[model samples]
Target: MRTSRPWMTQAATRTTAVHIHHQTNDTTWRSYMTIRRAWPCLVFGAACLCPLPIQAQSYPERSIRMIVAFATGASHILAIALSEKLRESLGQGVVPDFRPGAGGNLASALAAKAPTDGYTLLLTSPTIAISPSLFKNLGYDTFRDFTPISLLATVPNVLVVHPSVPAKSLKELIALAKAHPHKLNFGSGGVGSGSQLGSELFKALAKIDIVHVPYKGASIALTAMLGGEVDMVVSTVPATIPFINSGRMRGLAVLAPERVASLPKVPTTAEAGMPQVVVITWYGMFTRAGVKPEIVERLNTEIVKALRMPDIRASFAKVGLDTAPTTSAEFARFLREETDKWARVIRDADIRVN
Candidate 1:
């Protein structure tokens, strides 16, 4: 209770100050250690919230898969040719899976639902564009579910007739058809096929009533014509070239932009006096929807480059397919326009497949 000596008091005060300083130091150190221990958790929580960016350079690091929706036909030819070119360009092999059934619907559905990682691609013809409107319960949407890469090639459908048909030219045939509506029956591979579409388009544009006789395939259709079962047949140039050369079937017009080399003597549909009767079975590439725009652009660039190579062109030309290269945007627009165009034709013609 008594007052302490001044020196001792001063020393006690100093001791208290030293004790408080030590407590403060200990509290601060504890707080710092708590933060240090929790720093990893905070960082880990942040990382879990945000994913790191993937390097785009490592893209296409594996073999790409191409889905072709046809049998061993023009679509197959296009897929093989394009795959060969892509192998040369991408340093990776393109394995083609031909899922040919349901009017190529099976393949299109699978391709539409495939992963949008630039690995699984679809190489199909205008059938992709035509099927949407041609069939009512088609599972996949063409433009919505697909990312158009490029328009690969275009093959003309040569309109041919059995020698029994007296019509020598398209004008003669149209006049004959108009003279005898529904009397002139045209053969096609199947309903909603390229041949059928072409034949239907001709019927509508020429305002003729040509009945459609669908067969199992173009060859079969042409065979029917040879047997005199059908009056005329709309078939691929390659399929009907031999028949035309043998003088069994007569070529009236080529439904293409210009005269095909295989049938140079045959006038184009436009040249035949119907400018809107171009029926090209075009082949194009598409990927699954929701693909990154940059990835699509890259794919389009590579594919267009592949199509331009002379080797690719010559190989395709051998089969009467002209390698048609177009930008992604252009191809998309073309798809849309063709869809609308074919839809109109299908509706007007009342063409449908169950």
Candidate 2:
């Protein structure tokens, strides 16, 4: 929104000053005209390039505080992972504050009241976007109270089964579940979690009946799978990738539009002949609204750079997270679209939380 940059103005002033002085000296004037004729206006790569603003130079004068919506869920893990890379890029420690409760409302409420100095931020999942639709009284307006910085990554929920299960693919799993009725058990992190919603969407699309088993967290749900307490678990790639890769758990399908690069052999639900079965669990970063536009752009630039690093990309890919960095404006648009989409799903499913 800011078109006039102070640095660009300063650069243009210097260019004018030099040209004015050259007008008085015949030799200098000839040199300036020759250079100008060769380079033209826009192509003039003179010392007239704009530098970064002074305010951006001093950003994060101290440690940046990142607030997480979940105490020990994927949001916290993602914040920790990105913090390491962010600290390396910004030269300041990016601290994570876990304020988990109220179905992610507590963190958003606190972040809304935090200073708009770019120090305090929120790292959240679809819960924040889904709050308005799921709850009767959401404390903070997601679109109004926050400035979306970047979409950190898109983590697909995989339909994973213990090796003992007979189903080898998503279609096979559906057929088997249909025949077995309520005999099959599907695990989730908890009620209303991405894992749960993804599993529910699968049931509605595939028309299979599998009892839902809610665990305290994703780690425990995964543990239940390893112990044979649950037949299948539709969890994030981060929690299921290692087990799936090691042959301990078989990946039936990914709940994304396309096959994941990390799990190349696994087909997407759409590729498995069920294009309606799509569930995306994502991670995103947001600063309090009303922060300076320049600082917001600077944060996006550095964060995007960090995500582009080879080591960072590998670490995220290893867990089945696709690096999806975007401009602040683009992220804002995405947030609105996701909020609208989840609203319809929650309303149609009659999802409710106390």
Candidate 3:
């Protein structure tokens, strides 16, 4: 050790302490910097390694439930055909589940509360619009409770009389009803049913006093007609076309703007001099409200495509249905118009159901 001046000795001691403190500070700072730089990368790596539950780009991952509020057969044959086609388009099993009752008001109420997902849908007729005015106090608001995905098509009703009724044509039926007054009875599926409205329209237009006999369903009404328990029926062409051809019933006039392809020889209500007697029972698809617009659009597109398929078109034609699909907005507009038109008819005719 070398001897030094007092100030130099003090300075050396202080410099050693400063150098140690500086080294400690530098080490701590380096450690902190290393941790800070590695933390973000570590977090990013972990995020990339973990699985996230993201929604699929496409929808309808599971089987879809279609609520059918009516019976099967020619009555629902076209709807069934369309459902099968929709299944193919959606890459999912679209099943029809029937729960028919209350003029389809029951199924409508159930569908209104179903999940907003596209999995649940309603395959029903235009009775949806009429029900609002038909029923005094229904559980759901027809227009607000559901979303109309697409208008499938309209099935024109035909005025048909039982062979025993003695009415050869629409003209003869009007004359007979006018002569017979309240004694000329007509049967319908039920009070406020599409058939009932069709009959009412005919009565209103022809200015006749015909009694309406309500049955449980269209089949029942047709059976009553065949058994001579009822005088006549204004039902769908498909429902009564075979009977008409078999001579059990006589096709008077079609309740369409034009004659149906299946019944070309038959005249339209318009051509029969009763243009206001038109009543078409339309069928379509509706989804639960709050469904995403994208899903609704997808469903509408698939339905329109399904309706246009040649086989589907032929199926509807065979059943005397006009197979056409309308957009959501268009369907909404049609529903409003139909509701208004029928409201006037119902009010004017004093139509009521028990």
Candidate 4:
């Protein structure tokens, strides 16, 4: 065999000697040195993987800003109640920043571009689902720009008619509409408002053609109905309950799956033989996409907890809102369903907003 090189012989001898020493001596010091050599790598790996947990634990280190889609009305009330409750639970000021404009799009755009740090949140109604179909140039993608946290509450819309309309029930109204297609008309808050969509859904399912009269706001539309300016209207329970109770407006059916407690006598659309006409003004929480899952989970937990509180539930109910807390995944699926359903309704009805 060829003679071994000098460097190879030296390496073999050193390896043999180290092996012998390892076998004969205690390995505590050797192990310590090995760990010391790997300390930086171990720290780097941990730093990469452990940050989320650490951040989650220390989250809400400061006040949180809640962007309310509507400056006033049910949404604002819901935001104030939710913020006050969250402040109590999270020990941080959860401030409601009203950014109402452009049919709730201004607040949505602001929320979509907010940092994914869980500090800025959005409390909005179904406008998030309806805007993509109603407006052609929305600043944010409804599905892509936000992460749904939870559904806070819902207020069902009740279909009511002027006492002069002579429709005592949903069936009577449908028959009347079919009997006189263009003669019957319904009023709404605006062209793209929930009341309009609810009436459109009702029209599509019932196969009737009731002319639409859009007012500046739902309150105005209800007032018009009260004054017999419009034959029918789909309005929130709180706004129209007094009228219904006072016999100023005839409640045909509530556009929801179940009869509301406030209007226990009013049958739901489903009970009225049209299960597809359910339309409720829903409020939910959202954050910018890419927020850490841990933070989202924490927020959802606290929100659901706050919603279930007796005081919160009672407060919401006073305004005809029912506590409807849902998990994040469930809320996401619900949002998608709402978006698709409204999209179809808008397209079929040729609904558009300028």
TM-score of each model, in listed order: 0.81, 0.74, 0.77, 0.84
Lowest summed lDDT window (length 10), candidate 1: 3-12
TM-score of candidate 2 versus the correct structure, residues matched by position:
0.74
Comparing 3 with 4 on lDDT, the higher-scoring candidate is 4
TM-score of model 4 relative to the true fold? 0.84
Better of 2 and 4 by lDDT: 4
Model 1 scores a C-alpha lDDT of 0.74
On lDDT, the stronger of 1 and 4 is: 4
Itemize residue pairs with steric clashes in candidate 1: none
Q: How well is each residue in 46-72 modelled by candidate 3, as lDDT tens digits?
A: 446753223323677989898887776
lDDT of 2 by residue, 78-121 (tens): 78888887898789999989998876789998999998999998
Write candidate 1's Cα lDDT for 1-354 as tens digits: 110000000011112321211011223324434543464455446446754335334556889999998868678887887787778777789999999988788999899778878889998877788888877777899978998988777766778988999999999999999998889899888887778877877776677788888888777888899999999888778788888999999999987545766677888776887655666667889998888776676677678777767888777777766666766776786687677667767776777786
User: Local error of candidate 1 at 214, Å?
Assistant: 2.0
Model 1: residue 56 alpha-carbon error in angstroms: 4.2
Q: Candidate 1: where are CA atoms >4 Å away?
A: 1-56
The CA lDDT at 227 in model 4 is 88
